[model samples]
Structure formats: C-alpha cells, structure tokens
Target: MPRLSLIASCLLGLLLAAAPASAREVSVPPWGSGESRGEDLSIWLVTFSPGDDVPSWWGHGSLVVEDRRLQQSRLYNYGMFSFSDAMLARFAMGRLEFWVGHSSVGSTFRFYREEDRDVRIQELNLTPEQRVTVAKRLADNVLPENREYLYHHYNDNCVTRLRDMIDVATGGQLREFDRAPGRMTLREHTRRYTAVNAPMSVLLDFMMNDEIDHPITKWEEAFLPDELESQVAALQVKGADGQLQSLAAKSWNFYESPTRKRPPAEPPPWGPWIFALGLALGGAAVGLAAWERQRGSRVARMLLGLENAVLGLVLGLPGTALFIMWWVTDHTVTYRNENLFLANPLTLLALPFGVALMWGSQKARARLFKVWVALVGLGVLGIVLKLLPPFDQDNWRLIALILPVSVGMAGAFGLDRVLARLRGGDRASTGRSAAATSLKAP
Candidate 1:
C-alpha cells in the first residue's frame, strides 16, 4: 500500500519501450474487396493466467498477430497502465486508465514465461480479410490517440478488451454464439483467482458490494482470462459452407506454471463458520458466568476485556474503511455496501464503554448495555438479509465471523444488567423490612 516508487515506474516504462523492436504496421484494406492477402497471417488469442504478483493476480489477455509478408509478430496488449504519480493516484481512487500497447510476441511470451505464469495460446479461425481487419483494429487501438481507455475491472478490462476486439472482427460472432452459462457468479470467478492470497480475497469481498452477486452468462463472465478463453474455444461463426464453425481452430499452452495449482471454486466456505462458532462459544461462557454472579473470577474479567478490545477494534476498523470507500473513493463496486451496518465505526464506542462497564457502577453498565444490544441487532439483521428474498450478496464468511461476537457481547452485557437489577431489588426489600420492624417496636 506504499506510494508507487517513481524510479521503478520509470524503469517499467523503459522496459516496455525497449522490449519490442520487430513490430510492424497493419494495413487496413478496403472492406468487401475479395483480394486475398496470401501472406501467412497467424492470429492468436493469448492468455496470461494468474501468477504470484499482485498485478498478475487477475491475469492478462492480448491478441497475437504474425504477418509473414512483413516478417512481424506482435502482441496487442490491452492491460498496459502507467505507474506515474497521477496514474497511481487515479488507480487508488478506482479511476484507473489502461491502454492498448503493442510489443513483439517473443517479448510478451518471454515476460510471462519468466514470471512462471500460465500462458495459453488459442489459434483463431479467421479469413484472410478478417485477419487483416483484426490486425488493423488492434494496431489502431494501440495508436496514441485511441489506446487509452477508462478501465473497469469487470466490464472493460484486459479479458473483455480481447473479447470485444474479436467480437468486432467476426461481426459479433464471439459474444453472439458464446451463450453457455457458468455455475458460478462473477464474485465466485474472482474468488477462484484470489483464493491463494487469503488477505486480498477477504479485503476484496469486504470492499465490493452486492453489485457482483448475480449470476452472469458465459459471455459476461469472459471478463476473466480463463473463462474468456474457454468461452471463445466453443464459440461458433457462419462458415463459407453456410455452416457453423468453431472460432478457435486449435488451443495450446505456451507456458505452464511449474507451481500452478487448481484453486478452490470459491473462498473456503468453512472459514466463516469456524470464526462465528468461536464467538458463539465465548458468548455462551460469559453469559453463564454472569447468570451465576461470578464477579470474583479475575479470569472472566480478563477474558471480557480482551473480547471487547478485539471485537470492538475488529468491527470498527473495517467498518470505517468500508464507509470511506463507499463515500470517498470512486470505486463504484464499494458503494452502497450493506457490510457497514454489521461493523459500523460507531461500534468503536464499545471499546471505551466496555472498559467503563467492567470497572464502573451499575448505572454506567446499564447505560452502555443498550449500545451492545444495538450492535448485536445490526449483525442479526445482516445475517437475516442473507437468507431473505432478493438478497444476493455473498457475505456468509463475514457474517459468520462478526455476528457471533456481537451476540456474545450482547448476552454478557444483558445478563450483567439483569443480575444488577435483581441485587438492587433484594437490597431495597431488606431495607423496607428493617424500617417497618423498627417502627412497630417503637
């Protein structure tokens, strides 16, 4: 999360500029000209699958074209972005600008291969004219005026760029013919890639709102590189014989990561459950102790204080962060988040109240008990919404981790209040009896 290094950014630009020297211009022949460019025109859908680096975590996509007539092989990449101060600031604000960039196919492949990333190459089925059209479009996209675009991760990223370019070249054949639905939603697809980085996956789920919940069609899910390649492989277009033909003639991996492993279909489902159960158990124990009036147990006091500090800080920090993201940042995906209710920064008020309740009088404890109950109610509402109709947010993991702590804190605080009230009632009754007996004797 540190500021982007200026020197590293400069070096990155230099590396990209120096990587490809054998690139050539693509010609745009007039449309409907039956002239065959007899050149060995090779068009490929290049997919650079995820690697260990944060930048490559979502993977990247590019179009590779080799025109033997010009002895040129170039990769048209739609994932390039400057790391300048202004660009980094915009990226952090979620208004990133990415650009189409061209480099030698050799250079592109070498970069991914050296990173130990998984790289797949699918030879595209294109007519000589279609091939020239794709090349020309790609070249035009890489031009200074046309290259830069507003980058939206799910809708207008590297993968979607390639999908769109192919769609345009084949008369929208890729999107039109690729209609099979996937078993997972866009959120699930994202989880598959980020699972290896648990913290990143959790942070992503926390920041992104319900915008990614609903199921997406295969064409829509092609925002991911793997999904895009798979969808395109089965895509069909009208052939010369008036029959449907596969868009990809053949597919093979250019570089397979030596350390690559199959990621889980989604983030581990059991993680939230385990975390919630721990909170529930702690709450039950504290409630039982309060019911028995175990004020003398130093261990209970210590545990209660520890719970308050941990839970209060845990809930408060992320809630504050999420709230800021919703209002302050340009990340549309982070806006209108429901997670705010569960972990409101206002819950941080509990930390101070918790200390006072442990050491202060019954009046102080009673006053703060309502706050605890309110926090618990918020968490319950979040959990309940997860089961209700039209609620599609995938936050079970979070609800599981947070709700139990809320429940435990509420129970402990409530039981303490009940015991305090009962003790006060008993003391008042004894005073009344003594006064009545003394008055009668006099």
Candidate 2:
C-alpha cells in the first residue's frame, strides 16, 4: 500500500516543472465524477469498465487522477509520466484499465507510483521554465517497454482511475503513445501483457543525478515475456519503405505450464496397452526364431535375446531423441519420427534397453545392440550437458551429442569382452574334442 502522507503532496510541486507554455486544463472522465468536486485527494479516480461487458471486475480498488500541467519542455514528459501514473492508478483498481506497452522490455508507455520505489518526494516549487529544463533531462533515458510497474490501479489505492488518460482519448489506442509494444487489441490481450512507467529521472532531478533508474527492480507478471508469446504469432513487421516482411515470430512456450499440471489418469490405461504390446512383440520374436531354425541357423538363442533388445529399444528410445531435439531447438515442434516422440521418461527406458542388450545377446544381435546402445547413451549424455545451468534456451543445441558419443565408448568396451570370451571358449572346446578322439582311436 502506498501511503499518501502530506510530505508526499508537498514533494509533488517541487517534483517537476517546465518553461511555462500556456497552462491547459485537464478533463475528468464520466466515471470519475464523485459526490464532491474535492475529495481532498491530489489526484482523482476514474473507472472504465470493459466496453464489451466482458465480466471483468474493476470496482474493487481505489482510483485517483492528478492534475499535471505540461509545457513545451515537458510536452513529451507528459506523455511519459502522466500516462505512466495513470496506469498505476488503473492497476490499483484490480482490473485491466489500460495497457502501456503490453509486456515489452524497456517499453515507453508505463505507469508508476513514487511510493513503490521507496522514493521520497520533495516540494521544489520551481518556476515553470526550470521545470521544462528538468523534464527534458529525464527523457533521454526513457525506453519504450519496461517490465516495471508499481502499485497499479488495483492495489486498493488511487492508481487505476487515471492510468488510461491518453489511451481513452485516442479511442483506446495505446499504440500511439506506446509504440514500443508490437501490437494489440483490448479483446485479445491476456495477463501476460506488461507496461512500464516513465522512468523517475523524467520527473525528478535526483533520478538522473543519481542514476536511480539503472538496474530497476520489481517486474510484475503482467510485463514479463513468457517462454512463448503472442507477439510472435500476431504481429506484422514493416520494412524500410512499408513493405510487409515475414510475420514476426518468437519461440513457442513449451516449458511445462505451471498452471496446467495434473496427475496421471486413474487405472493407468497404459498398463493394459503396455502388456498387449509386449505380448505381440514376444509372438513376433518366437516366429523369428522359428524361421531362423528352419533355415538351419546356429544363432537361435542370440536372435531371441536380440529380439528382446530390439523390443526394449522400441519401447522407449525415440521419445528421448524427440524431446531432446525439441528442447535443443527452442521447443520448435516437428513431425514424429517412427511413432516416437523423445521425452525424458523415454531416455530412462533407452538406458535399460542398452543394459539388457549388453548382458543378454548371443552373437550378431550383440553387435547391433552395442551400436544402438552407444548412440542412445551418447544422446542422453548430450542432453544432460545441454541442460546444465550455464546453457539456457539459447545454447542447448551446441551440446546435444554428448550422450551419443559417451555411449558409443561404453558399447565398444562391452562388445570387446563378449567377443574375446566367446572365441576363447569355442577354441578350448574344439581342442578337448580333438584330443579325446585321438586317445580313443589309439
């Protein structure tokens, strides 16, 4: 809550001034008219319910409007602070009053209250000309979109009523003053929208003198950009001579949404689906072994184990790869490869399959298992390295192969031991048989 002490009011007059241009009177909105012209408030509150009867709740908080005089020097400053202040009042009322630069970094159209920053106010009582000089000094640092808003119109205070002054005048056209936001309409916007208030330096000397606006704090959810944003999907960008370029795009919001998590569905239907698939695969393996035996193959046992390894690979490997591909590439979606969409859980399965194949194989199946296991292992390792804290959304692709490479080495070593033991045993058995035959013949 922002306390409006007498000291705050006294600080207001001294806060800003401009070379006196003809002073113009400010108007009151229809919703702002109260029982008395003087509510004993320095600022008045105006409420604009949503025009479309959208069931938005706006009356719960206090709204205030202040009379700020603008001059040539303070002309731009008015656009900055007055609008910014008005927006703060709107948010305090606990509703969407007006939008500044609807969630952009360093957006110009904004609203803010002095109390939010713990900034103290002083009464300067400067001549009109001096005010203009100070106001100009502040404009140099004003950015178009900023994720900073303090005590918006809905905070049980007087911030909401006055936030959309210029916006209301332009028939709810915020883009005129807030060019920083890419584009928007009232009906289509959501909570992800953000706005920034004019920097304090624009209104006060100390703001610029002390560099108070640098490294600002207090970013509200309304202003922060989500992992995925509408601007990329909706906005149209114009090139130098006003030709429409390709539609603006941003990465999709693919991170697990905090708002939509749910527990696994009851009875876990996958329980049955999994069993059926295993049975089918088992039947296929039996048929394969039977055919190989009819062909007089000596690799029957090895082939059966190979079948298990292959089934395990099918049970889980593709999901790991698909998810890694998506994450590494900034959540860009693509078609599934081989009915497999790689995901984290699938990676775990890939590992087990690799281990199973390593221990169960008889011959050629072992070699194939080693190759597949190595690739999957390396892929998993790559995903891990990419996910390390230092590598964020920007650099994930760079380390995507760490798992594939690492697994390749493991598979190689395992294959070597299997080959050495199998060959050595075969040779020993042959020697024993030949020696026994010679002794018996003699």
Candidate 3:
C-alpha cells in the first residue's frame, strides 16, 4: 500500500485541527484538589471505534483525566503527528514519530462523533495515589521535550502506550495477563480490522511476513484498543477495605454510531475465493492460447499478449515492491515475505517477450514459456518449504492465486513443444524456422 500523499495528510491534519474554538483549549485537569486522597480526580479510558480511513481502521484510544472540582476534562492523545514533508519522508523510511498531546474532551469527542465512530468510556477504579500518579504522568507526557517517541505499530502504538501507563499505575497488575493465550496472531488481528476494506486487507496480508504469525499473549494483544478495553474491564483490583473490585468502576458506551458498525470478530475467509478466481483467470488464458494456436488469428494473438501483459504487471509490481521492502527499507513486518515467490519479479523483466509474442516471435515464445515455468516452480517451492519446520509463513492464499495462472500460461504457450525443440538443438532450430515459414504460407 502506498503511503498517504502529502495532500491527504495535510487535509487530515486540517480536519484534526478544525475543532470549535470553545473546544480548542488544552485543559490539564488539576491533580491537587486539597483532598488528601485526591477525591476530586478521576481517570477514564476513552476508546474510539475504527473509521473508514486507512489510518483510523485500527481504532484509537486516549487517557482522559477529569477534575470533578473544576468540572474540567483533558484527553491525552498519543496519536498526534505532523504532515510536513520532513515527517512524511521519515514515515516513508519507516521511522515515524508520534507524540502525546492534550486536547479538551469536548473537542476529541466532537471530532470522532462527526466521523461517526463509536465511543466507549470506562472510569478507572484507581486509588487516590494511583490516580494522582497517572494524572501527573499524563501531564508530563504532553510536555514538548517528553512527548515525542518512536512508534512501533505492534509494540508502542497509541493504544499500547496507554496500556503501559495503565499497567504501571496498577502496580504491574496487567502483567498477570501474560500467561493467557491470545485469540489470534497479530496478522489475524490486523486482517480482522482491515477486512472492512477487502483489497487493503489482502494487500496488508501480502506485505507482512511470518514475524506476525506467531501466537501472542493476551498482554501483547492489548496493542489493539478494543482488546485493551476488554482486558482492563476484566481486571480486579483491591479496594481500601481489602475487597477485590472491578478495575472499571463504571463502563458505558458513550456514543454508538448508527452508521459505523464494529469490525467482525474474525478475518474474512478470502483464501478459497481468491484461489477460485485465479483458476477462472487461468482457464481463460488457456482458452485464448488454444484459440490462437488453432486459428493463428490476429485477434487471439493480441488478446494473448494483453493477458500476459496484465498478469505481468499485476504480479510484477507488487513483487518488485516486496523485494524493496525486504532489502531496501526498515519495514520489519514486510521483510522476508513469502508472496515474493508467487509474484515473481522476473515477470516484469519478460515484458519484451510478452510484446514479442504478440508479433509471433518464436524466440519470445520460448523465453516466456521458460519464465512462466520458473515462476510456477517457485510457487511450488514455497509450498514445499511449508513442509519444513523453519518455514512457517501462512501464504497459501497467494500460492493458490499465482500457481495455476503460471501453469495455465505455460501450458497454453506449448511448454512441451518448446522443451522438445530445444533438446533437438541445431536440427530443431532449422525445423522451427521451416515450420514458421510454412505457417506463414498462404
């Protein structure tokens, strides 16, 4: 997937900054309210549901500190970033910087409400000291020098940052969740959320490597906002009287958007469907090749060339990107992708052969046939690797999509005849030339 263009980023920045003047004040709730137990302070977890945009597809969360005495609420958001060229360049280089910034609760809620995202709030049941600590930490986090931090999608994102702070405030009680197994892998979680956009889901799955496929702990799963909310709601904390109570003093759906629905619990079942689509395309290519071979018609040959070109571009472009992601960039999740075998870069290199085949070049036919065979072989190799203990990438969907197409195209172009002729050496070359001449005869 391409990075957000500068224009889109700027527009998003503007939208984020366009809050009403009354809601624009940066309010930090007063932590010291004269009460020895800090009775006037309250902390809440605010979670916003996923939105239509790519960036908002994973959802977001913020820490809200409220001062009951002053009736003021401040939201500490860790998802802020600039849209300047320098920041975008760094983002493209996989070194994005995000910072914590304070905004009025009114402004934050207004923006998300306008976007039609669901909002949930949970009042944290923290002791007075814990509440004071969390409030002060959030205040310190928004400071100019302290706010900026390196962002890691799975480990140190906005949600995870809030999760860590909560865990610390609870005296590491959240660490108890490390023993529980996660429902799915990071890749699956990502697919589940992004499944609302089918193409984007597949593209992201293709780009990510096996690093995200391992089973994680529930603690790790808290990287997502909803997951964290669920885990936090289940937590039990000891009260002043030594009785265990729910960590969430109160929980409620603050705003449930009628237009936007929550993402599905599981990722879409797209593998089999994509495989079937590939088979259909491959069959069509074979039929076209057969028609061209039988009639030697100009139209059939043109269609054959066009099919090859289209397939080449579709496979080659992403394959080239995968190559760059593995060796040229710092996107760790995209490194060592298994899809590279299915979408071979050699297909791009064989563009001239595709064009030549359009003009009835025998040499191009031979070369293109060889390239297709190599691609098919690589696809098979990927499957074979799956049988080994070391290769555990879940890329069957891609294999299913690319393998049959390679096989069909190779068969369509007469791979057997090409190989037989090549084995026959000098005699076969002369025979091919005579055959070409004879076919051209009126």
Candidate 4:
C-alpha cells in the first residue's frame, strides 16, 4: 500500500507537469495593497469539491487560491489544501509575497506563512455589480481547467472550476464520466508550495483580506490604518439551505498576526511517523479485540502481526525511499518511475517472506523476523535522513510522503495482524503478494 502510494505521489507530480493547460491572469492589487503602494495585487481562490464536474482523470483540486496581494497560493483536492507554486515572472515581472496551509486527508492539516511582507492593503471602491461579478466569476470563470501549465499551476484552482463551465457549455456531453451529480466521493490531495516562475510560468494572481466574526482590531495589525479604513472585506456566500458548495471559495478570518499568531504544522521526522503510526495503533487495537477469537494462538498472532509489519515496512522501504527522493520535484509528467518500482523483483520476494514471518507457525524463523525488522528500521531511518533538505522543508510538499508512508505502514501492519490470526501462511493459496503492485497504463 505504501509503495503504491509513493508511486502515486511521484506520478501526481509527473501528471501536473504533463497535462494539457492554459493560463489567464487577472489584474488586481494585492488584497490590502492599493494603487500606488501595490500594482500587481491580485487574488485567485478556487474550491473543487466532489460533486463538481471536474474529471477524475484530471484528479480535481479543492480549496485552492492564489493571491498576489497575500503572495500566497495553496491548491486543494476536495476541501483539504495541497501546496503549489506560481512563477513570479508569470505575473508581469513583479515580486511575489506568498504563504501556504493544508491538511492531509483524514484530519491531518498543515499551513503557514512563507514570507511576511510589510506591505499594506488599500480599499478600492467596488460597485455592487463588481462585487457580484467577482463572486460569480470566481464561481464560473476562474479555477477550472487545472494543472498542465507545463511547469506549475497559475490559478489552476480556477482553471479546474472551468470544468464546470465546460460541462455546462456542452450540456454535460464533454465529460460525462465524472458527472455523478451527488456523491460524497471526494478524495483530497496533498502537494507542493512553490515561489517564483520557472520555464512554463505565467502571471495574474489573487490576494486575501478576510473578515470573519473576527476582531476588528487584529485587521488593523496586518494592514495600515489607511488601508483598513478604506473598507475591503470578505463576503459570506451561503446556499438557500445554508450548505456550502463543494466548489465554493470563502475568505474568512482564519488567523491574524501579533495578537493572534498562526501556529505551524511541521513534518514528522521518522518512518511510520504520525499517520501510519496512528494506523499501526489502530491495527493493534483491532488485534487486541480479536485476541479472544483465536485459539491459544492469539499470542502468536500478536507476535506475527509485529513481524509482518516489520517485514512489510522493510519490503516497501526501497520504493518509498525512492519516492521520497523525488515526490515533490517537477521532473516528470508521467511519474512512471515510482510506479514501476513497486513491482520490482526484490519487493515481490520480500512480501511472502514478510507474510511467512507473520503467519508461519510458532516455530517460524525468529532470526528472519529480527533481521527483517532491523533492515526495515534502517531503511526507514536512511530515507528519513536523506529526506532532510527539500523533503523536510517548511513547504507542505512533504504531505505527499504521508500517503505512501501511511498506507504502506498500515497495510503491512494490518495484513500481518490478520495473517497471524488466520495462520494464513499459504501465500500461493491466497494468490496475493507484493509482486502484484505496479504501474498502470494511461
């Protein structure tokens, strides 16, 4: 599971690079900055929930917005945020001020400021028509097409929302496959946070000046008195039923500076860290529950579960290590490298060895179990250490590692627990093994 997740993470980076794309930058001053103080101020926010028309093939994003005013852009899948970068040159040769925040699927969250600017925002008089237009355009015009700018997404959230436009334009004929109308099948993703434009960069951005049920005073802190006095504020869009749309973008007072600090969410340093570790605990809890069902072998099942988990951790490490090495890089369009590694020979052989160590009778090779456990610990350590610089940067790009690490860690642990309980030693009979994982053709 973890190996497959690594491949998926690496491949997602590839797909973001290889997809078909377009670019459109809206000219707006940074949220609080106005005319003289700021010229390139812009804010682009997009949300892609499950029910929207985005194609599953495109792997839709959610809650993503890029604002040059705030100098921040965070992409999302479903409602959770994923990190993404915008080329500064992509925006008419102006300097960028940015920030990022996102949580992983299953309640994990990460977000923070990358660079804090002393810049202040000004309030421009926007006509009611202009305000409606901006809101509707956000709902309609921006954040649709998604990805494929050849390098990074310049408001891909809005481009992705364009999927809705295409669907409406074609009367649902363009992308019938993903049009399930009302299914809660949204899958959130986690990815990178980038700054500056490389090669395929483009311009136009968004800035945020939020005012929830927040203190009017804190707003004064992040903005100049003149700017705050000008009166630009966030809008609240609620459906008739008051339910938030999957594709809705809202500017809320999530946090403010000085008086109310925004705490950071950091990366886990070791293997089986955080999420997977939680999963292991979850599996252990389940094993504890099943303890009563097993004949005298319950103790053996617990031990085997430990062994299977260790071996799975070891077997999946190489692919995972390889994945962590390049998970957030913009080097591939097809991400086929990690995908291919999952099916490698060594991984295949190791799966059964792991299973045997877990399910083999009480007399199973304790030596093999100990050896595999040591190897896995080393493999995890080596990868975590190698992951130092970029992988562990303050950037949310590290979130990509969570899926693989957690899944692989959990799958191995869970399967081992089950195999121990069942004494399901016959890998051939079950006809399942690590060799079964691999890349898929598009």
Give the residue spans of candidate 1 off by over 4 A.
1-38, 83-89, 265-267, 271-303, 351-368, 382-392, 422-442
Candidate 2: where is the Cα deviation over 4 Å? 1-345, 350-402, 409-442
Q: By summed lDDT, which 10 consecutive residues of candidate 1 come out lowest? A: 10-19
lDDT of each: 0.68, 0.28, 0.76, 0.30
Off by over 4 Å in 4: 1-350, 358-373, 376-442
TM-score of each: 0.79, 0.24, 0.85, 0.28
lDDT of 4: 0.30
lDDT of 4 by residue, 1-442 (tens): 3443443343332123111122234343222122222232222222111111111122222232234445543322221222233332222112222212232221211121111201122222222333333333333323335322222222233233333332343234324433223111111111111111111110000010011112233222211111112222322223235543322222432222333221112212333343454355435534543452345455655554564445345435534434443344432221323222221223334455545645654333443333334444543453465455432222122223323433343444454456675666665545555435432323
Error of 4 at 176 (Å): 40
Query: Candidate 3: how large is its RMSD?
Result: 5.7
lDDT of 3 by residue, 341-437 (tens): 8875787755667788788777887787888888888888888888887689877777787888888887877733654556579687889999999
Reference-based lDDT, residue 187, model 4: 10
Q: Measured by TM-score, how close is model 4 to the native structure?
A: 0.28
List the candidates ranked by lDDT, beginning with the highest. Answer: 3, 1, 4, 2
Residues 292-390, model 2: lDDT tens digits: 445635464445445544544433333443343333322122122211211233334434444454455345444544544654555555456545653
